[model samples]
Target chain A: MHLLAIDWIFLLEKLILIVIIISISLGVAMYSTWWERKVAAWIQDRIGPNRAGPLGLLQPLADGLKLFMKEEIFPASSNKILFLLGPCLAMLTAMMTSAVVPWASHLHIAGRDVPLQIADVNIGILYVFGVVSMGVYGVMIGGWASNNKFSLMAAVRGASQIISYELAMGLALIALVLHTGSLSLGVIVEQQAHQGYWNIVLQPLGFLIFFVCALAECNRTPFDLSEAESELNFGYHQEYSSMKLGFYLFAEYVNMFISSVIMATLYFGGYHIPFIHIADPNFAALAGFIFLFAKTAAFITVFMWIRWTVPRFRYDQLMNLGWKGLIPLALINLLITAVVILLHTQH
Target chain B: MNVTQILFWLLSALTVFSALVVITRKNPVYSVLWLIITFISISGHYILLNAQFLAVVNVIVYAGAIMVLFLFVIMLMNLNADAEPQKNKWLQFAGVIAGGCLALVIIAALKNVDAKARIAETGSDIGLIENLGKVLFTQYVLPFEISSVLFLSAMVGAVVIGKKN
Candidate 1:
């Protein structure tokens, strides 16, 4: 059988790794919700969920249980299949982005080298961009399927907002891509490690633009016009209930976690510790994993911090900032990078 | 069949099915969603052919950006309800006949082609981003630059059309 030509052991190893990474992502996303609330309370000078378990670490689990027990409501006038499909797509795209992220350097175990990523495809950054773009559909479909005027309006706002910011985000990323000259996330990280300077140092303006666009992309504060409560009354997910609603909310946190990881990977030198060196490959790999996790966690905290600190933008203001402010800035950054690279190469 | 062949067949079937659904769906929003599914299946085919960059770009451009715009316009028009006006019976009949004739012509044109001979293995590295970029810059530089100019003009045209007096 030609199928026998495939290495079963390697496939088994990858399957196990996939399972581990997925569960870890879910666990991190669960805790991020708890962390977000706690941070919000702290910023507001109030005690956060302390009753659940050790600083309310288990609060997310309780919340999950509550959501599950809540009654699922399908609006009589709503499109049933599309309504359900919305959150499912949101969750699916959220998880899909993780496939290209390299958690750590390869681990050498039992004389076999195991890479930490799922698929090290050549277009890793583009793959993430593609999946991130797909996330807009979840909001658009959910809002339109609700058969509510407000929801439809919010969905339209969301689709335009995402499209506007995505151009700036792409241009900002192009500057970084020029510096690294590779689309592979692993290669980008390695380049940063070898160069001993993260992309943020060279592309500070690009990073700022990218970070702002990331906030807008994730529908977080300052750019969260899609879900502006006072204006649109909870916006796109207004008709969602029970675990269906939970999935949408959970998907946001998951997207937050994944984007944080991407930001850390792209700008903060991924798994490369600043001044640490270990001779042993195994020890180095372990340290890289821990360092990458620490970086991701720090970024997640920043996301929550900004979410609590900033006010949501008005819809027109959001659109203006995305189109007028970020896009031109990103284009300028790209041009400057191109010129610098050309000069450097000539010299 | 081998795994690649099996995957190709599966993706082809999915793409065809979704394309049919895209045309047949009564609701325009549902038609747009099915169109997205068709694009995704086409991307799957690109991946099977080892063109990872093309696959991801296809999803990003077609299924993600363009389809979202399609859905956005559909929602803005409030066309989720069954509002499409049925075409005249004779016009519909003519449309079907024309479509069938086109299909027959395509099949006939390909009938004498050596399909097996053309099914040779593609260069694996040709689809990699590095090689693609090199070729684009060195060999196709003029066309690439001209395409950007075209996009710039299109953007300007859109702005002009969208501006309020």
Candidate 2:
């Protein structure tokens, strides 16, 4: 009976952690909008959103208010059920994938150690991959529901793009898996406890492939063909307005945040501070959790940086990279890694 | 029986029903819908087996990508419900008989094996992509490489069959 009580308490703690994570993600997404505009403005030598508050910090809040005030519009000919479902599904999957990520090591609360992650499923990496891949459905469904030819076309292109890059991403991940010999994110991070000798050193090619695929997967710039402004006029969610539009946009940023966390966890040796091992489990776990957030923030900034710097790839070129370039490169990387592991084992 | 057992029965029924609809349904859209249902129920079975990766992959590949392709092609071709050819009753009868015989054999084989709970009690680095890759490359190397070649050959065959003169 006591054991069951302890388990229930742990479960409650985990649920609270997840709720906190979700709120933090939403908050970051709101600020990200302000940061993006600021970054873009600075590049163009202009002050962005200065009217909202000091440094325009309140811009996100103002924007949220404006969205709330605006009338919700549904297209007359649209499929009402799926139209509503599209964004909700997108947001739900985006939120759910965050559960498996080990944000910190175990933390001692009231003398009982609590895991920072919501669910430390053994197949954490695959779960992340699966959820991220499902993200395409939201856009596809949204576009299809809009009952517009352009929307349908954008959705089709988006779905094809997502499916194509996933293969390359999976292949790149295979090389990393070969190196780490584990799929659990927590175990992978633990393996990379030492700083400077991260998996990035052994699998630079995999990191490159993974990062490029991340950009394509997130539908960010240089691969944001699905929503090229002049071409598609906001792409898949063009018809969306108000909070519905907000959901679509929010889901994208949340996905970006989660993928950045995944990348940090997977390749950047997540939550590991080099040569500085605080022996206390509590402090170490706290440090690791903070390190993860810090690393995730850095990746998010890099994502924004790349978005501003690079030009969008043409649709055909994007497809070519996925099918011809990245796919073949990934295969070669996997083959080489296998041979290396084989030779080492033989000796 | 407990909730898990009851849920298992429900999902198994759903899987069987969807599998039947996938083949027997005349409308291509309905076929795709049935396939998605089958995939979801299979994921339920994987949950029972404690294999999260397999469950997610079952949904991702079978429902997400494959069914999308099926739908895309059907829409592109404008396959209408009325245009679908009628199913031959004799073929249906033969299919049911074969399926029933296969199920019986499977059940009989399962009954002969000792039933034991083998739930993983320890947290071990197993069933991850890394282990799967190692096993595939080391022990199953020939089959792994051969399957890729087989896939390539099948792709070529498909292109040949699909080409418009």
- Candidate with the greatest lDDT versus the true structure: 1
lDDT of 2 by residue, A116-204 (tens): 88887777887787777667778877887787777877888888898899999999998989878778888898898843568888898
Give per-residue CA lDDT, model 1, range A17-58, as digits (tens).
Answer: 899988998999999999998999999999999999998988
User: Which 10 consecutive positions of candidate 2 chain A have the poorest summed lDDT?
Assistant: A1-10
Candidate 1 residue A200 Cα shift, in angstroms, is 1.1
Candidate 2 docking quality: incorrect, acceptable, medium or high: acceptable
- Deviation in Å, model 2, residue B87 alpha carbon: 10
Error of 2 at A319 (Å): 1.3
Complex DockQ per candidate: 0.75, 0.35
Q: Report the error of model 2 at residue B108, Å.
A: 13
